[model samples]
Target: MTPISQLSPRLLWQFFDTLCSIPHPSGHEAALRQWIADWAVERGLDVMQDAVGNLIIRKAASAGMEKRKGVILQAHMDMVPQANADTDHNFTTDPIQPYIDGDWVRARGTTLGADNGIGLSACMAVLADDKVQHGPLEVLLTIDEESGMTGAFGLAPGLLQGDILLNTDSEQDGDVYMGCAGGVDANITLPYEAEPVPAGHQALRLTITGLRGGHSGINIHQGRASANKLLAELLMDISQHAELRLSELDGGTLRNAIAREASALLTLPADAMDTLSALLERRQQQYRCEFAGIDDFIRLELAPATMPARVMSTSLQQRLSDALLACPHGVMEMSRSMDGVVQSSTNLGVIGTRPEHIHVQCLIRSLNDEGRNRVAEMTAAVFRLAGARCNFDGAYPGWQPDPDSAVMQLLLDTHKELFDVLPEVKVIHAGLECGLFKAVYPGWDMVSFGPTIQGAHSPDERVHIEAVSRFWQLLVRVLKQIPER
Candidate 1:
């Protein structure tokens, strides 16, 4: 896979390359959706779009497999748009530039979109390649999966005729997932009043960066440092040692991703402004030691910045600082049944200082409704106690595990036959559309698996090359070995 264009599974790479050349970030997948719809029609397959822009394509079963169970190939069409701070790229207009890096395919200073793009490409390949044996097939491509799960939530009942759904949006290759976490978004707001900066005060820009921020749900238990949480803690500490007044505060981009960097603009007494250098230096050293092998390059620094006209009132600044510091930002609980698996967690993903009120965003993930709600309640209480209003939205149900699943057993046996090693079955912590699909297709049996992907929802995102070959091989065989109805 030195050059992704020349990779094995020729048809899959062909469609993936086309996807790379199209800009299809969350909520902006019209161009890609239309192109895919036309491609399906040109191939003489039945294609249609649902009310919320989900693209569905149906292909007849092979001659001998017509009596087998109908299988649905599912993947989200939209991708999380995240780029490096200095990278000059636009998710809405610019094509993703992917190149082979050793055994992986990575994008240039941006997320590679392999989270579901590769999965979607596989669906197209299965439709075009007649040799890939399958039963009655239906491909479901959902939109806005990254920012929100609008597409999955809006998917209507009785639209699909499939009895078994094979979700291809999972990241790791060696793991077959049967259940996944559900999630809710915590939107927070705190009203504040602006006041004139005190006399003889200077502004400084404090930055926390160089942390490896991974996907909030998948990597929540990895002990990675959150830049937003770090910044909030530092601000609270500085207030105790000096007269700190906040002018602007902001960090992170998407709620589904852990914060990689955060910055604060504040005014301190000019005479005491020199105090931040040593403080930042001390904190940086401590943080590095604390996160030693994890966030290897975590950093904290302060620089002189232009003076601001006004700052948040003393009371508001204190409240915001306290609230941010008190908010939850890591794994809250671990699964007792599964060793080392995260059961519930939260990411303090974003913060912004608007004109009138400060906005804060969080994402909570859990394997059950009670688990997620319990964490959400704890988080909401922290913000509410600090005089902020919080509301939970985008609540989706978790996928339940089925021990007696015939489709799952068939997939497992097929994988073992192909690789001589059984894939690890898991109930993952990440939120996938299969959970929401349960609401619409209550009787459909679902299982999710995909090629190995690393650092998803972040600029360091990349997909394994050899693993893709194995993933494709397994999919091809599984389709051929589908159990008869």
Candidate 2:
């Protein structure tokens, strides 16, 4: 029960603790935005809300530093809301309960919001302190970054007057991110007509749990299982041996997250129950062997359940199963230039049964336009051919790298001076808001860096204690040395 404010770099942690007290999950940042706006006004700083609810807070330069280049500190205000299935937590109304583990800060039964929360906190600390020397400073806090790039897309040009933008959203304290992948969301809906359950049918619930589902982009190359895709495969296989009808299905909640759990209600002939159960057991063993070291805790089970009055039509059931199996999941291509980097990937993020039809969500990520388009096209084709309507939504461009950037050199030199070791420059597979910024502000010289965070977009998310201290130190140095315009 250690107080988060007592952690090293008290100012940043103090701000983070306050953020945790406010529920700011994706698409619900109004409360947090109001709190920040009022706080800035109290300090006599200039703040304004954009058309899309993005906050732009401005503070004048420190004494004798007005001649330096203007810098914009950027981060998202929303966090992915994820909690353990058994935990009784409500993200919309409940404050995140964070506690200290050995060397990290974790939340009880939910995500810690460390992906962009920690970065945004550093901005708060700087804005409140007049002692930190910097040029004319601006903080751009965007909304709905976890679910969609709503704020980034709606950002109008001629708003931010900064020469450079310092993005604090990337994980890994030392690795400097100059570029990131673009992505498109594939929203598929398949129509279904439920038929009354056959007289000879019996119902059972099949569940798959215990997979270490991390961020769909950051952890795509690790070969961890996707619960939605896995459950689809299991249902399809078991159906071949018996007359199986799907009653209900759901797995994974967010389209941008790797699915960690899935479940389905199925109806089959009572006599064929033992055979289907046996087949499920066999497939579970095969899955364990495939994802052996990566997802060692994978579990597949079936239990007796009350019989439902109706089930999906056999045609719709088969088509849904066929589409899910054919849908692309995991790394599709590797970067030729960067060793061990994913060039293109797609995650079968979520699948669920709604009132009228079944819907599927898949997120495609790629460094190049061609790669991203190719995967999006492929994902759409799979669902379309299976008698479902598909859409390509939230399509954002990739952030191309600037190897010769002056801002990058300033950061690298600052790091070399402080830590004695140069930080590695990288282009991550994850979707960052920097790419969207290019559409409005093309002249921005941006470099993204932050404290080490692991298991983002999952309930196991945590931020490193020591890395936050170094992250703050590096940021403070970079702010002071932004080049003269």
Candidate 3:
């Protein structure tokens, strides 16, 4: 295997390559954590790994930079493990198949892991570079940032000696992220009765696949299609036109992602099959036209399903479909503070319809706790109206923006000096580890910046290759300009 340094450096590509070589999916980051520890120890640097598996590598102040204030460079080590069912790769133990595609680097049929991996790669690059002048640096790499941010939430307070912290986890290269939305995951359970298949009704599975899916928070306002929503729409329409009886319904995998594909098993009325097929054709075309520019590969298909021993009650099926249709799935409001910034949004992430009860999961995000709760309440209301039980989790707070931080000024000025342009400063609707970090390190001045990455949390995730150089330049510049104590 080619070393990571052959294609990229500051240890950037190399560390990313090594990281990809290991399977650091969410809670399963032990191997990667141990590998990172060994890497730090091999360089004779002081390293620490917390109980939660958040790793920190400390490099003593460099020469004259010793007297300067200490700084913390942070990034998450885990990636959202997403792959198509047809892909042979196993995220639990397989290396990412990364390749250069013109300006971007992407994985084969899986998420590129650039969301935080780029941030991780950037930190590794800085640490491996001896030429970059800077004060004492501590690289704080956390685990499980994708699912629950357990690593961030579990971080001990005052563990770092640094007063200035830089988070290299934001997506856009030309953006300095100051704040972000807080979020929570909610699950609703609806217990319903099911019966065995009725004779004389043909059993078929309606599958809808190939829709373009993306991050729920960042792309929610775009009005992209949701698999759960699409399946419900089709099934509801079928119910109107035919005496359809549902057996099973399933869609989506991650609660933080916009659902892309869905499948449903049902028995169609003998006479309405033709009408249903025609309606589906028309609906497909209509949806294609509606999202022609966004989702070019939307599909709807009906295929034979093996006979099942159970089927949902007619009332239950109707209630489930109605609940999904009534629930909100997109942007609720735009930022009043930042122009074009999404302030509040909801994602109807996953749905599973079994013979017993249906399970639905939704992730809600907002800069305000009240707004977040409001959206959650609105979501639960739908389930309640449909006679389904609802449950909510503790809400995570948003990172309150710090505009006057010294680090922000340094990064802003550094960008202007090198790139000849001002970086965009805004808050994102998506969750980040920074919020939890801030809760513990309240005194730390923080700002997040990174290379351009796209399609995170989805199989199409990729990082801009050339931007890596620019990102390296920015980090080196900021480090070199750190003020002396």
Candidate 4:
């Protein structure tokens, strides 16, 4: 494995390597915050912390650049903690182990945190480097961005003095983002009755794994299968041909991640084992063919397990399965206004059967407020029909595009001059902190861009090495070209 210190743009990689060693998962950014504050204080820079743990580090302008517009470099400090089912790692205590894999840098068996970590590292590099020419700079590092926008939501008004904000949380390189989708979370729950297992029935655990689950918003259009939806379909199909009772059900990890694995404990007639095996094989083949290009390693496993004492009643089982099948899990509509842009989508992100009730959660995203509301209502209606109560929360607004802004032009011209090619300027479907920032700081101009990262929010997450260098160059040049206030 190649050491990250040897990677080009040494300072950026060095900071990122150190960041990976700290446990900074969403809602647990205290250690990282202290480290960042200490690093800034060691250099005699001004560091301020808000009530909600958002950090603001100030750097003075270099010689002859005091009159340039103040720019805010923004990124989140928390990361989504995810790992493979077999990897024995804990996000709260264990450090992320990253190594070079060809052209990318990936963690051993967990998320690499490069989504915003790389962005934050760029800001650190700029603050540490005296050779880079720039105006007065404020680096805004927020908390709990991956799980919720708590830090951004609680940011006080008038906390920042910058006129323009440059967000570095985007995933793709060479693409400047002017706008992003807004999102809301929908939670549904249904109560059930438990019954004793029937005579002559055997217990089995059905496991689904090997799917390449990814970020729900970014990969929703790629036709990757959702384990919750797929398992529901299988259970529904099996219930038609066999006397099966569901005892336990669980899948997925977060409200914003597509489920890669699911499991169900079931009691079925002993004679039906052969039939169930054949059905699973057939469905597995069908799914493999459907998701060929993106998810080729899909697998279904069945093993004998200790018999559960009780199982869901017939009426409740049927209703829960029906609700799961009816729930939407992919792109609902595309933007007619912007070519090739996703307008509305939903991810049935998590499902679990608890002692008192069965819970289902989803994340809906859209470019416009009306579209976001429409999808949330539609998803709620699906569960409501099955006698489940639904609630929507954690709603965040979308960032509107500004094509004529001076900062946008500066970034465009800088990229063209540096690379001799025009960069793509467009809006993305993923949620970004800029939307939340815009709500409080209405007059501030904003744009987002970052190095290329793949499989974020998943164990396969990796960052492209060369793209980080290119992104650093672009950022430094853009800092030098900030317009006079």
- Give the per-residue lDDT of model 3 (tens digit) for 113-226: 888887887787777778778898999999888888888888998678987888888888788888989999899899967876777788898998887788988778888899
User: Candidates' lDDT values, in order?
Assistant: 0.91, 0.92, 0.85, 0.93
In every candidate, how many clashes are there? 0, 0, 2, 0
Candidate 3's C-alpha runs over 4 A off are 2-5, 8-10, 354-356
| Candidate 2: residue 252 Cα off by (Å) | 0.8
Top-lDDT structure, candidate number = 4
lDDT of 3 at 226: 93
Model 4, CA-based lDDT:
0.93
TM-score of each: 0.98, 0.98, 0.97, 0.99
Q: What are the clashing pairs of model 2? A: none
Model 1's TM-score against the true structure: 0.98
Quote the lDDT for 469 in model 4: 97
lDDT of 1 by residue, 138-191 (tens): 999999998889999999999999999999999898899999999999999998
Pairs with backbone N, CA or C atoms under 3 Å apart (clashes), candidate 4? none
Lowest lDDT 10-residue stretch of candidate 1: 1-10
Worst lDDT run of 10 residues, candidate 3, spans 1-10
Q: Which sections of candidate 2 miss by over 4 Å?
A: none
